[model samples]
Target: MRCHKLVAYSVSAAAMVTLVAAGDAWEIKSQNKLVKHCANREGYDVCNIVLDISDTHALCSVCRLNRTIPDLAKPENRLRWSKLEQAKRRLLIGLMDLHLPLEAPVRGYSRGLCFDFLEDQRSNSDVAQKFITTGHRDGVITINILEADDVQRVWQREHVGERYRTLLGHMRHEVGHYYFELIVSDREGFGQIFGDVDTAYEKALKNYYARGPLPGWEQSHISAYASAHPAEDWAECFAHYLHMADTLETATAHRLIEQFSEQGDFEQLLLLWDRFSASLNEVNRSLGLSDAYPFVITPIVKNKLRFIHSAIARYVGLQL
Candidate 1:
């Protein structure tokens, strides 16, 4: 997996982590006798801890390859890093749930998904730098640590006018980029559906960034970010599909939604998704919020999502 070139460091020396079980909490076993606990936020799972308190930010199995960590010496920064870590774990869990292939291009090339959580000068008043980039590449995903701060995230959210924004959302979006490589680079049937992805991705991306998206992009693209590149378009759509499917599955599991056809085939899933999404939008309106799944399904996009479903089914050897 190709790694990002940038690195993160703390403004102050590291502080030892201390563990305590305050009450009913989710915990996971670590290499040592110590137990790591979940931060207990929505969309997070227990398996995502980077270290037990006794270990003082020691890397967990999943966090071991991290070349750097954002400096957390500032009192406020420490709280931000903790929140970011939880969100990162939740995002990773969602990817694992999708059963996408993982592994670095050169190292665990066979299978493994990896990430780098970083902080740049933009977020730390003590740091001398002025900018940070947030995106994904190769096998590794890099997130600017500033995103962990609510004020920064909220500012960006409003500036972008995005309906939904969360750490998990960013993770999902980046994973969309990763799967582009997995499905577009290797899957034969996928090429037929998504088109010849070999069409000079770099040139297309440059054009997208320079000229801006095509007019009437809202008619098809799920988000403005999708307009940045074809691969980004694919990733944004893929992430939206997962968001819909997973949330709908949870609703069905809890009897909030009727069970989808037992065949659970892709077509059946679409049928269920459509009805559920409509209801979801209605519920959001009741709360004075925007639609939960906010995009129309053109026949073209439907075909693309079907290809995504089909590819996943084949990888898991599930009949569809």
Candidate 2:
């Protein structure tokens, strides 16, 4: 939120941050209320939980979107919040690096973005809700804080028979849905490319859980859960697209495939990703860990990724 400079003190940190309020856009306005600089700011020690950029700005762009944070009184919640913030920072960094439309609605974005890190009864016995499904809706992303714990996340991943699951993966997946609503939802060729998102998702979800994904799902979809709905397919592809972009940036920064690093060249990225991911998997195998990237990107799934690449490029006015 834009505000004139003002002083605010941190109770937990026992420190005073100088006058804060500046040009960087992101207001802490929840759906039900406007909460300007109103967070306990309990997430990561380095997540800039208060988003103290300078005397002029109070929050980092990513931390500014937080609508609800877990109870900081609990030492466990503090650690969990830290992990969630790390994943979220990486996710937003990719979005910013890709030049995605990420401004809050107050800054003229079509929708306002916010995050809610909550605890449900399943995870927190005293919480009101029984279960909290991590998802995005109306620009609000709700993440069940339980995902921050490795044992719980891995248990659910195995129970669901998933090849991969991580806090970062969850962030990437849910943010994909947020972008779909903004850039691709009403665009031409989306239906022809991904499929109709207007189908009955609830029914489709029930059927998907009951009978599993379409036979030979990996022949086309990036992940089996993508077969549950058109939105899921698009979201899955979007997540993979982000995976490519972020990984390429990291690989290039480390001078691995530095020669192949070229922004806006989608084909080149795919080629480089294939070479790098294979080596990455091999490196993991050398260490007795699972393959770093498990799923194969079939020709059809590759096209889906290509579409995502093109769509994002078009969104940012980058050709090819």
Candidate 3:
């Protein structure tokens, strides 16, 4: 887990139950017997229920990944942590759906996905630690507790000129680094698909950060940071694929579009996404907001995404 660092939900504000639609063909259990509003996105295969009960913690068997819980010293912090957990679980559900291997020492041998919801002095004056970077290292993903705070997240968003940002996006992007290790670093046949990952990662990263994104970078990358390196490119692409697939399935499940079952299989899913994202963009426009999905999925990128889908299908024992 240390060797690689490529790493790379929803439900509602209050009501305990709601339904999720996965195209027209699939309907996953949205709520557990406890009536916790839930939906399987990426990591649900391993944990029947991704979120913990109101008072307990649940271990993720597939990833064997749980570290520290956020200190809920402040009354509101607990609620924030719970919301963060929900987002984390939803993200893991998507990773599981992809069938990408996990690499955590806790889970032993290629099974690794872990989290630590940590706090700092900013969030809790009593805490000795002053700052915590949200990053992944040695089989663990550590998120600063402040990220769960609305004020902090919004501040960071505006500082970055990003069209979209969220706790789930951070989780997904970091996990993208993790999966890069799993699929590209150590796996064979990856070079054939993703190009050689041997390009100096550290050097590329420095240049990306120093000069900012390439001029007119939209022609090349989905986000400014994506131009950092090939590894980053892969991670960004991985995250985008998950974003696209998850939203499409949810939209389909909600009857926002044609039923997925009637539409057909994975190919149909792609078609649906193409149609749905346009409306999603326009809806955001009407609200004077950035497009929900701003990046264009180029033909080359589409083929790369298909490779990811094929990998997931193989993991699930489906004939791709």
Q: Top model by TM-score, which number?
A: 2
lDDT on C-alpha atoms for all candidate structures: 0.62, 0.76, 0.63
Give each model a TM-score: 0.71, 0.82, 0.70
| Positional deviation of residue 32's Cα in model 3 after best superposition, in angstroms | 14
lDDT of 3 by residue, 1-320 (tens): 56442111222221223334434322324442222222322323222333433424333242235568765456776677666776876786666545555554422234477888888887778878888878776557788877877788889878876666778877887777776554432244555655567788778777876788868657656777777776676677778878876786567668898675321366676778788899999998999997888778666567666666665555446322
Per-residue error at 221 for model 3, in Å? 1.7
Which sections of candidate 2 miss by over 4 Å? 1-44, 48-57, 106-110, 185-188, 260-262, 318-320
213-295 per-residue lDDT for model 2 (tens digits):
99988797999999999899998989888888888887887788775432468788898899999999999999999999998
CA shift of 146, model 2, Å? 0.3
Q: Which runs of model 1 end up more than 4 angstroms from their true locations?
A: 1-67, 101-111, 125-129, 185-192, 201-203, 260-263, 318-320
Model 3 Cα displacement at 78 (Å)? 1.2
RMSD, every candidate, angstroms: 9.7, 8.8, 10.4
Query: Which residue pairs clash within candidate 1?
Result: 1-104, 1-105, 1-106, 9-71, 10-71, 17-56, 102-112, 103-112
Q: What lDDT is reached at residue 300 by model 2? A: 89
Q: Tens-digit lDDT track for model 1 on 21-129?
A: 4343222222223344423222232233434446544345545534455664566656765676666655554555565544555222444456676766665656655
Best model per lDDT:
2
